[model samples]
Target chain A: MRIAAQAVLYAAFVAVIGYFSTSPAYVHLAPGEAVVKLSLSHAGERKEPCRTRSEAELAKLAPNMRSPTVCTRERVPVRIVVAIDGTTIFDVVAQPTGLAKDGASTVYRRLTVAAGRHRIRAELADAPGGRMTYSATTEVDLAPGRLLVIDFAPEAGGFVFRS
Target chain B: MRAALAASLDACEAAFDRAFGQAGNPWRHLGSLAFLLVVVTTATGIVVYAVYDTSVGGAYRSVRAMSAGPPAGLALARSVHRYASDALVLTMIAHLAREWLRGHAAGFRWFSWLSGVPLVALVYASGIGGYWLPFDRLAQLSLTATTEWLDALPLFGEPLARNFVSPASVPDRLLSLLVFLHIGIPLALLAFIGVHLLRLTRPRSFPPATIAAATCAALVVLALMHPARALAEADFGSEPMTVAFDWPYLFIHALQYRTSPQLLWAAAGAAGLVLAVLPWIERTPHAPAACVDLANCNGCGRCFADCPYAAITLVARSDGRHLPRQAEVDPRRCASCGICAGACPSSTPFRSGSDLATGIDLPQAPIRALRASLDRALETLAPRPAIVVFGCASGVEVASVREPGTAPIELVCIAMLPPSFVEYALRAGADGVMVSGCREGDCAYRLGHEILRARLEGSREPRLRARVSRARVRTFWGARADARSLSAAVAAFRRDLAASPRAAGPSMPPKRREALDA
Candidate 1:
């Protein structure tokens, strides 16, 4: 009886290995990127954050960057904002970095940048380092921006980053 | 019909115990502690390789870093991985050979033989996967050889090696599949281990001090030496570098490179089948049933429960306590786990006695306790010419621990004292600890001295200088009653300590080296 059981187990083991050996799917992600989408509903029923694609709306950044201005990991928080000039050349979604903090760090619009001064202000994600803000202006020249809000959060989050 | 069924069942029960008698053997289990470490290795490897990226150059460094990294778990995990692999293969081989020698693996058990072949294959598959992860020169060559061999099979369409040219030429997805196999194979190996333990009561675990110290020391040394650096990332097209083989399993791979892969597989499979069916093929003669030491019996019911056959039953004794009652071991119904013997507090106080038991006698539990006491004493003692003294159970007990004196502390069986406690004593400010057990075979427990001797020799740890050198904590085995032997052992150890220069007394926080050593 033990021998029979051993045989059955061995066969099952082989079958599992043979099947999965061909290929297996896995999760992939880069460091420091947090992906989030908001769910808001004006009517009675609940709904997902499914704002549809309209050329005009996709082209513009959210004007109220200060309202939802905090992003955190653990207790640390990073406050930042996304701003763009009238010229549109880069898609916010394509940009892996730079997003706004409304207690969150996610981009919502496609903004273009060229070789000139542009300011993206950010603060430490949490306390002890609160009230600290850093701003830098850099040049960017690339394809004309499309509708993408490259969402980002500050390093202040308690999220322990694995290097 | 009922009578015939009963007779057949009896026969089966007897046969069962006849097969697994060694499961009760402490030496066998002591040896198998290696299995515990190996299991740890496979588990850690599965986790590390799971997250590994399989691209060319990246795969090697990533695996190297993961295996040798400073991460809290990575280095320890890799050590466990290697040790476990070595231990599993060693024990499996030992288990097979012991079965063959005992004539328990033959005849009607052919199915076990055949099934075991796949398990052996899976072990090799996991081993190869480990080799591949390093992506070192040898790793690339090994993979190339493997792929080339696969291509030789009529079923394969193309030579996969053609893709090794440029980074873009090789498909990352396909490489990912190989990495997946590397991860998946070990997880699959775990299933085999589960099956292996199904029929047994408890799978063996590593002996804490010996196994832990040996495994850690081995890893530290290996890390200091080879450091497990990766060879160049595997290129599908490049010719592999020539290298030595890992004798454990890859010997066959090297042979395959010389001969035909098909022939190698056929030979391996055939050999494995023979081994698996060995228990049934070889027949062990039935011996008389084991006698019970009822006086020592605590009525633990271990023997009663351990018996695979219904030969032993628990019945009310004169004092109204339940004890195992003997009945005929209807020869047809037994599989000798002697778990009864191992579990039997009566028949086996510490040692096992089977219908056909191994001649090794283990010291009783009291002796083991005495040894542990000696260990505890050294651990609690303060610095002196800090020295640990061990004396056998039958040896003279000193009136009291003479502070800074040259007398041995008595113990029943030194095997019960672990090496770590000695090291711990040194860290706590003891100069050294010493142990004395009975002379070789003369020990009342036949193998007590031998077992203690093996452990003492194996107890060496570099970081704990006080633990390793004879001047520090050391061990000697002689008749417990032999004052001359005890005095000489103590004198020698004391002389060594006194001759050596003493360091300043213990300071705050101790030294950095001792803290980081483990």
Candidate 2:
């Protein structure tokens, strides 16, 4: 009788392990849909351009940090917006990823849409201005289960779309 | 609410104890069982780790082929790693909860408890790293979610989530870093485990063979029943319709997506803070440490040998007297349980009350006071067949065994009752003596049961006198819930005492009472 009970307990223990080891599927996106992922990791242009400091200004600084060319590591926050078929699908004002605002401003947002051909428009603004720094408008046919990756690479021109 | 939880834990333990018996009870061996699972996990992982390709493009294919087995041993090996790892994490959590609930996080255990806070994080880091080696859709999701969560903190100047943005952005060398991290972090965890066990003397690091075998068998059966297979190969540009998540390791990923990473970090930080400071929340109740009497100590080194904590050490006797060595207590590590006093030969109750000093003893519960308590208890023990019970505070309720013509003398632990005390009670007019304590492997003072056992069996110092009738003595080691078994043992001892022709040891000395009163 004790053996029977132990067997039962052993079975229950294994069942729990089996159930939790891998189960309860996580659905990331709805069926018959494609994703338009706006992925950006770019350092924004400086809020203010570098300026040559006066000799007095340089002398006032600590000996280790003092320099004639005063270029701040802090960069301007970047604002980005992406629209698909004239509908604004993704929009964000992303701050640089550091405590001192001295690093690249990154944006990784996914927009789910129906699988079809659509006109995509993307824009980026590096400074606090109505003027745009980079913009691209393109037409791409996106199939279901495929990702339309909208990425930023200054060397390859801004807002390159990879489908 | 805590009391309710404790009572429920007790109930569950009692139920399991009956089914598995004391030796096989998982509740009794939670810490050791977790260690066994760790060993199992490492063994299986070494096999799979040696065989699997650690490249991003090749890892998923290799793991998938390993799972869809032509070689059953390799397939089983991979499955066992996953299963054993899952079991390892769950068992560790269970072990932590049991220790916390039992109020083991406070007092001398402060260091052990505080060091364990990082162990929880290490377990997650190690387990999540294990999943990433497969490079399946689940691994993709885990890696991406983990990086995004980590990105919320400013530790990295640039966001880490950029690596998961597109398939092109993820470098081939990234898998190498992940492999290095998976191996390196667990080695750090192993070092921390060493630190955790440092304070404990004679640490029980392995479960009994029966438990180890059963645990392995259970995992093997689980692996056979449901072989662990990888999800479809990862594509950063795509997501699987639904991915099967390893809930043990990937639950954090689930929670991160469900809530903001900042909120999750806040919760984790709050929990870590609470756990780190939990030891100081309550003060140690039994605070009086053991002290040594230089004059009475012959420096036999018995107390030093019997100390469960490495608290007592032998040093050259400070006084110019020609003693070989003397016991010194480091009060910080001393438990003040009086097991050391029990092992001290000078702790014999036969000492006169005017100068009842032992070599080493708890100032709070001196063996002299125990002798006085014995005297008072024995004087009142009514009826012809009086039985005196010796038990411990941390064991069964000693007072609960009190009955007609029966009385109990409680000590801090059963080992605190010197073997001479049994003979003293027998000579002082008690018909029989019964020594009881915590169950065999569940000693509150760790070595109390073993020390007392050897002493009574005449195998250790201050041995029970052979002239004392063995039939008139009884010993029962029972769990706290085993009061019924204790009562039954007492009843049987009473019957045996009645059957025997009242062979009481030599009569008490006539002038001993005057010396005791003086």
Which residue pairs in candidate 2 have backbone atoms (N, alpha carbon, C) closer than 3 angstroms, thus clashing?
A: none
The candidate scoring highest on TM-score is: 2
lDDT of each residue in B123-156, candidate 2, tens digit only: 7898899998999888888888888788788676
Best by DockQ: 2
Q: For residues B126-232, could you state the per-residue lDDT of candidate 1 as single tens digits?
A: 77767666666556556655765564454432345333322344566655777788768877866766665443333344544543454445444443433333444
User: lDDT tens string, model 1, A1-163?
Assistant: 6444433433442333222221232111122222111111011111122245455554464655323323232222333333344333322221112232112222222112332333332222223333434333323222221111222223433111110
* Residue A38 miss distance in model 1 (angstroms): 57
The per-candidate TM-score of the B chain, in the order shown, comes to 0.50, 0.95
| Displacement of the residue B412 alpha carbon in candidate 2, Å | 1.4
Question: Which one is best on lDDT?
Answer: 2
